[model samples]
Target chain A: MAFSTTIRQAYQDELAGLRTAGLFKEERYILGPQGADIEVEFPAGADGRPVINFCANNYLGLSSHPDVVAAARRGLETHGYGLSSVRFICGTQDIHRKLEKRLTEFLETEDTLLFPSCMDANAGCFEAILGEEDVMIADRLVHASIVDGMRLCKAMRDTYKHSDMGHLRDKLIEHQDKRIRMIITDGVFSMDGDLAKLDEIVALAEEYNAMVFLDDSHASGFIGKTGRGTHEHCGVMGKIDVITTTMGKGLGGASGGCVSGRRELVEMCRQRARPYLFSNTVAPMIVAGTLKVLDLVFASTERRDRLEANTSYWRRGLTEMGLDLKQGESPIVPVMLYNAKLAQDMARDLFAEGIYVVGFFFPVVPQGAARIRTQLSAAHTQAHLDKGLAAFRKVAGKYGILGKGKREIMEMYGK
Target chain B: MPIDKQMILDYVIREYLEEDDDTEITYNTELISGGIVDSFSMVSLKRFLEKKYNIQIPDADATPEAFDTVNSIAALVERFVKA
Candidate 1:
């Protein structure tokens, strides 16, 4: 039996609204390795040469690293390409064990468990651990995966008004008698390019007798002096209870994720977590590639150092241009534009100028919080950063956003 | 003793649970797998039961079977008060 005509019309009508509202994402076809410069072929737009990439999450410049590629090739030669089974069912290889151990040691955690993706790691965590009697306090601005995980767990869930320690304290007091309480937050908020106050969270958890869970997907590969993530950045590396991160964004841009914590907690999750227990394991080649990336991260600080330099150069240049960049040290820099249409227009203009950056608007962020989400990479050269900044200034000025310098041009319209 | 089962059900459906306006949930609504109550909704339900009924619900009673419907949640609430 075919569906009713009303059902078909309803779906089509809803999609039409999305198009009219300018919220539909236009996916670009990337034709090169993830790096500072990218080549994209658009089906609709005017054909042009390859544009520079400013939106990738390849923070450490290791996506196509020779060592990482070589390691993946070796794994392919030795263990074959894919593991058809889950981790417990003949999918756990020697490299997986070694990588997990090395991750735990590198993060200074008791144990670690791997997952197919960071999204899975997050979605599997809350349900595996929290019970109905427990209480979970989370930051309001955490990742969508963390929110989904919290939705799947039967714990008393409450969110402290984003990064407000006083509100967090009040919630802790209200749930003081709960069996167990966990404070969950992202190490680096993706959109706003802000770092969570880890010192404050750790201190609050101590006073409230709560466990802490930090999803450091954005900070994992290149934050601290040793690149150990938010905990190391905050100088509380051993205090946090759980650390979840993804290998897709960093660690050679391979697809994998992990959660590191107490051995007992890791064991419990392995047995009970729905996604980890049911899903296929990380491919042998990906695991080997990740291990090599980790080795590179530890051996030399060049990648991280270069990333920091690129971030500062871009941020300082953007700031000097009088653009309102969110104040943070993370590589994710958001150039705020209060109007969604303007942000989209600015992105289109930037594309015309051979720079590729994505504009984020409401629904992704709160309404009126639209901005260009510019991501920096160690792969970005001095010339690349300069070109990107120049493009941004030109586009932003064209929109009358650069202030009195463009005042006469905008006033000519007699608005 | 008389219990306000309607208020209890409404609280569970609106606040403790993520209810859909597209569907109607009677006092005897089954929550789990029916898409009425998820894990987060279950947590909120537990909190509501504890706060409104003034009873502590143990883990054993926190399963989908116990919170299957408004009747089940009410039944669990009743059991908690008795215990």
Candidate 2:
């Protein structure tokens, strides 16, 4: 037994197989700030122009805002770079309290608790709230973090098929006798860019005697009337039982997440959740920057309006180009490419024309449901969007995906 | 005895598989380890069994070893009936 086999190497071999299967995705480095236009490192090409970036989560374009940058500089000067301690210890700075209080006010919740990442927010929420005697009913297409969190919980859990109200009702009725039943879902599905049926979900929760938890990471900073997220989008503000969202995407594009709910629940999570209790406090720079983003969201709707306009323009142009578009009101616009190879090829070809997008296939999405997820930012100008649409149309034609493009797709479908 | 086995099979299939026609499930086979039934479904199944058969399934007994397949689940049910 001195030299026994270790299956650890087998896992890496499997990943190699995935790479050869045309599913291996690697990140490209960005040498500049996140904005509508971004510079991606690639070989020198014709124009040497930066690609029209459509993949960043910088929805508000606050990542490089002068105010946000100034706030970060001030935070560094006042509080330094890192805390080197967790919240309950010496990590609790006065600015952390100020950020939490401000977030509570912004989200209209009694209290808010921050986590290192929204993934942590989701992973820690389940175990902190429910136990073995309780039950959790979640949407099938909720974020991966929620699935992982539910796995950590000892509570009985079941997933209703994505957005199927009938299936959810049946499962809720089946477990109607459980002590605590929580219905959890994402406010907007990140992949399809479609919105959840929140109004319907809320009504169902009331009938099932279940509390609702919404992860609004994708919807928070630029959705709804005041950009208050799905609560505002659905006109159900103050109706949701729990709201969990991130500061990483639309909020400011730095890094942090929070669970906004009743005073007691947030307090309970503060005392128990592993990440909140153990992880280092979020840097004061991120706190101050996110607080500024929130101020912008509240002070004016110009940015949100611009984002909506840009989304509509891109969606309409792509649709007119005879591309398959995922139906939704969200800014995430998925261009369907049922074949994984085709999706990856399209993304590569689009890059040749100075447009950056991400191709998603199986494991991330279901088989025969591959897509190119294009995100629009408020930072983009109409001219930028028009240029992107032109590039997309050119790539689609090259891939044989439009008019005569339909013929090539048919040939592949027959194969 | 045959009626009890059929009942267990029906319950497992109905509880785990949502769309019966589209989804093809093989009964009396290793369900959990094969990834056909996940841990979440297993917990719900345990709750169903406790209510249906009046069997108190302890945390220790709720493992794939005890109830991996329909046959094993039926055996557990029979053992609970006798106990």
Candidate 3:
């Protein structure tokens, strides 16, 4: 009859089991602004240690940019704080409309509808357009958010092998009986740091007469020649039927997302997407900040070019150090260490050495596919990279994983 | 005289597939969803097959069903192999 015996006890046992399995995730607090370098307080309640950060999605290094901060401040002065209601209510401000317009231009879409986050955009977009007659075939490695979004929709859910156009084509053929077939994928695979091969995907969609849905969250700011997105990068900008992206990562790293694509589809989302209809509107500060971010990215390709160069430099450094890495063109660089314990231990030691990185292992990634995901930014300097590389060498030397790959790591420490 | 399927199976087991007590992988075992070879590893497996067999499996030919088993994988390789 007791609360402890009935509900709390079962939950406690599961939590304890997770801890025993070494799968429990702990939060490391960041004491300062997010950037290439940050002060972190690990294990909590400890003094913040300054470290060169290599695990942030702040790809453009504009999270704390002065101009963005100024723009946000101006927005606060003009528009005030919380919207307290959804966009349909009195929450729709001039700034919000301006941001939507700018985002439409930036993303090269007919229309755009803002969401609380890309997660919301993903959650809301599917049910808004598709129904029981439709089929949503997503890439296997699409982000978890997309999977959840699909689960919420009435459309029958299916998946193709990640970036496998052949599988996608087959799925298209299998589902031709459906009224609508939408191919969904992430513009950039966040964990593996690989691209979605949008060129081939678009070609397949065109051949099958299926619409395409892309979550450009990771590629929104620095992917294309001028930072339009994977659509522009793949030269299929206007052809995509739906694109869901976030301002939380590559934009200003504040928080906001949008579903941008065909005018009718976006309007459908605005009208019926549950999150859009229920959730409070994005803060005015974020709108102004993201607008500035758009201005900065659209003004020039300096940040994108720098990010590409930085990726090359970091990849070269890690490769030369004999650390096995995932082959990728994006800023997400994962240094392979097959064993979970080794990945965690190496990340802990790297933290101690004044370099901040996270160990991704089972549950986060697959078993025997553990690694330390190092994300590069235009904010990262040559000196910062040199220090990070030095720290990596020191930590990898400690673990004896240098020049070792998955097989070697597995041999050294059982998978 | 030609490439053996066991060779491909061994490489797959060694590099990608993780077999359990009841699910030992052989020539006909499903390798994509069944073998638990995730999409990321599938890419690596495709590359391995290409290099080992001296063939380039085009993206369109690298379907989940085609790469579902060692037999299908072998067939795919033979299709692209110079005869």
Candidate 4:
């Protein structure tokens, strides 16, 4: 069969349109491990340079920690590399079970089951439990993976306004006739750094007899006092029906995720969740590294404290410098620069100033709410924070993006 | 009760296009194609229509052409309301 010229032309046209619209995504090459300070290579064979990283989800800074690395090395030596099987097959090692147990204790849940990644964990959960008679109501700003997961499930889907408890209550009342009503939301919305009103959600769940589900991928390692996640922060521990989170973010920055909740629900996922039943097991190295992260997180509050301090200090410095920031207590802070072009331009200027951050615009956020979402890390010291703040002030000043001048900048962008 | 185009437009403006000027949206105004109503907004709009008019918008009618403009949305709602 001949190649379809029509298909090729269609793809070419789409790619050309993306390029013209400046919506084409380009990946920057990082030459070193993920950390607060790292060398990165821009496109076009640009030379590598060290910059303060503000885009990583390494909230606890355990990504490249010496002890975590050592644990991974030991994990490789003892448990080998790949499992080459799913959990139910020959892949249920003692470490995997141990890690799941540790996660249950850390999350303060009934049980936990691991997946290859949080994406898979989210994908697997909804379909495993929800049936056609059920209803899955979600926050509009929940992660894309959750949206896709709900799509795959047979439940009738409804979404309320983001972070609006009144809208959620309305949705719950509207869907009260369903056999089971499941309310889904992100613990911390990644883009805006806003948290779900879990306290109110739990209350509404009780009023409507609905189950509350939280995907705490962004909140897992540092939101609460001991880093137990949104449940702890919201003071609703043992109330949420299900909590899904990742090791990819705060928990050592490796690749794995889990669903921790009721024992029956977890057991059902273990047996029926497609991603869990079919995909390869979590690598022993990542599991070991994550186990170490749990140990460190449980042993001491130093990292969590440093992370909280850094977040508050950075937030205050940025606000005092007159940068427009979204309100939240999460380490994920979004400096709003409404114009998409300005967001891209400011991110580029900040990169030139040796501060690495990405611009989010258009489809990632709403059309008018473009921003540079900077995530704080425990690894970012006081000096790193100061340097980053200085760079931000300088670049923001160059673009005239200060407090009173923000309106002028928006008008200049014709937004 | 008959379907109300102005009511539909007002709800869309209030919920999805809160930042947009009220005069900007009219009966024939483009919604999805004009970038005002995204996929999430479409879901919300469908639910709103279902609740208000007691009409179930099948997935087949959830296309951009079928619901892109306020006029098209009003027409779709009218069809189910009359049926």
Candidate 5:
């Protein structure tokens, strides 16, 4: 008749342990919409601090764009706010199909099936296509969503080193004893911001007669020359067997995801994936706003170009400051602070200097690999970049990590 | 010249695995099974060995069993390096 004290005490003890280890995470409250500049109220009930944001996934800065908002309003007016059923029921609207078709064209895949988020797409895609005799080989550093998706499958799981083709090739060979082999990777690894070696991966897939599955959540609307994603960026457009991407980041910065790839695979997901079969459809307004985002990105690479240029500028600025960074070619730049407390302390100090960045520690990254991950956006102005750099410089100076690299930081903090 | 086993041992204990001044990691110390080295760190350790020796250990040979000890890792590296 009452809640169990045993469970409550167990959780409380675990939480207290986390806080003692400095691994406990505290979330900041945002008083305004998503953007390069936001009002954050931390420690609860504190005054909102106006700061330049460097941690959001709002890569194209379209999260709060006026056009996208108006399109969402229109969608709400036309289709109402909610879909009370799943895709196969009364939920499939004309707008949903339109966005799916648009995504297939945008991603250069044969067909598409929508999901509520990339996590669901990741969870749903594997079980739909693979069987017990198959093997799903993924990168060691692939997203957790993919890992969970693989766990749901009857197929066996093996992992290659991050971006290690030789290792992947070994797995392919070893799993040659199986009926099918699927190579799973993130087109852009969100943490390190490195593009997967897709060209090489595709070449291996062709040679080994394996299918490739990519989760391009971080690179969908702003990666390639035409913003077609990693396939386009890597010259392997039609080669990927299953491509999953999100409309939540670069698309509309709202919420929706899709599995776009071989027509049969997409169709299979639509028919068999449990999430697609059971979950409520993505909201009509999100689909509508995403469609508008598609049009804007497809028309010209203006926003994409801005994001790329900003990434380059930000990367250069951070490098010039002599900060140790994980070298990559994506908009996510992590300022490596090997010590966990040092990272949290730096982030807190940076916030004090009117910059918003979060410290990523163990459980998110590896135990020794703590960092402050900064993201660049098309929404950011040169002024925002300059101020962010200034804040970073001030904080780095305070922590005495300004010019120190990984080895030095680790030595100081005993990683 | 043959690959330096001592360097490999020291690097693994110091870089990949956290070691204090008195932490003793002998050639026979269990690395993976003893929970000192995880799969992710094992990959980085593999990369370090590959880079230092200028030889690639095919992923099949780079298993947890082969990397469970400093001696085992050195012996694995010697095969490729000597070849």
Candidate 6:
């Protein structure tokens, strides 16, 4: 079959336009396992070097932990590799059920169902339960997966301004005529690290007779005192109707996700969610590694405590250096550089200085809101943070982006 | 209610660009193409216009040419209100 020349030309034109607009994305090659410090292979035959990584979602630094690796090895020995079938037919295993139970206990939910990725979990959840008569009012800044999921459903969709309760209340009132209403939001806004006001959302949901859904992917392993999730952080442990999150982030930095909720909702997802029904079962290695991760998280507060300490210390260090940073309690810190070109240049300079962080601009965020999002992990030591701060001061100073009298301020604060 | 261009511009500035002081947006400012307003914000803007003007904006007419600038948005509202 001959392909159409016009269609090919159209796609090529789109690619060229993207390049011209500076919106084309490129991937960096990692030479080793994911961790606080990683070896990266830069383009142009540059010698690979170890850089302090600040962009990974390995919040607790358990991605390459020894115990987790051993558990995954054990999983491979016992359960082999891929299952090659979906959960219902011949793919369900004892470990899958055990992991589900552990997740339920940890999240304080009635039931849990696993998916290949949180993207899939979000994709499958909405369409399965919501109908044309229903309405889904989401926060404007919810993750792309949730947006795509909402698009797939027949629900009358509306979005309130990000974390604006008044706007949310207005939206709820606007959609009051719908048969069923569900309020959806992310537990933590990834870019800004600001948390969803779940207590306020819950109160609004109660007043409007709406159900609440939270995707806690960014907060699952290290948000609250016990690290149970944002529900625990916001004092709404059992008030949320559904919670979906990922193993790819704070949980284990692997590939899997789940939706935990009431027994009836979970049962409905198992029966009707297309991704859960059609996709192959999650790999046994990931399941086993995640099980061990849960064990570590529950056994002690050591990692979470260290993570909190690291975040505070790093945040303080940057503030003292007079870098413009978004104020938040989450470990995801965004250093604001409003100009897109400046953000990209800063990221490149930081990379050259042995710091690995990505710049988010334009399409990722709104215009005039470009920034470099730096995440903290428990594995980052005080020395690592100090070095990273020094790099920031040097590069930002070169670009004349540092605040006035920052050097004197740093001296006053004194390392 | 009668549609007003200044009123639409005031609403956009207050709602979306209140914290932004570096750039001043006028009636002819390119919103969609310039990335000042994104798709999600467009939905909110549509709803706001619908409610305030007491008119319906079909999804098909909610394009950049119709709603990218304050002037265009006001024109769209006027068209719907007249209809």
Top DockQ model: 6
Candidate 6: fnat, from 0 to 1? 0.53
Candidate 5 lDDT by residue in tens digits, A1-415:
5669988898999999988978777878999899998999988999999999999999989999999999999999999999899999989999999999999998888999999899999999899999999988888779989988987998867777678788788778867988999999999998888999999999999999899999999999899898899899999998899999998898878887999999999999988999999999999999889988988998989999999999999999999998989898889998899788898889889889999998887767876788999999999999999999888888898778878887788888878
lDDT per residue, candidate 4, A22-58, as tens digits?
A: 8998888999899999999997599998899999999
- After superposition, the stretches of candidate 2 with alpha carbons farther than 4 Å from their true spots are A1-12, A42-49, A403-415, B1-83
TM-score of 6: 0.92
Off by over 4 Å in 6: A4-9, A404-415, B1-3, B10-25, B48-56, B74-83
Give candidate 4 misplaced runs (Cα > 4 Å): A405-407, B14-24, B51-54, B80-83
lDDT of 1 by residue, B32-62 (tens): 6554554443665676678877788887778
What does candidate 1's lDDT look like per residue over A177-210, in tens digits? 8999999999999998888999998999999899
For candidate 6, lDDT tens digit of each residue in A110-151? 999999999999999999888999999998789999989988
Candidate 1 docking category? incorrect
List TM-scores of chain B, every candidate.
0.81, 0.79, 0.82, 0.86, 0.87, 0.88
How does candidate 3 score on lDDT?
0.88
Q: What's the CA error at residue A28 for candidate 1, in Å? A: 0.6
| Reference contacts reproduced by model 1 | 0.07
lDDT: worst 10-residue window of model 4 chain A: A404-413
- What is candidate 6's TM-score for chain B alone? 0.88
Better of 4 and 6 by DockQ: 6
Worst 10 residues of 3 chain A by lDDT: A158-167
- Tens digit of per-residue lDDT, candidate 5, span B1-83: 67677897887766543334344688898877765666545766786788888999997999999999988988899999888
Clashing pairs in 6: none
Give me the runs in candidate 1 sitting further than 4 Å from their true place.
Answer: A1-6, A44-48, A403-415, B1-83
What's the lDDT of the predicted structure labeled candidate 6? 0.88
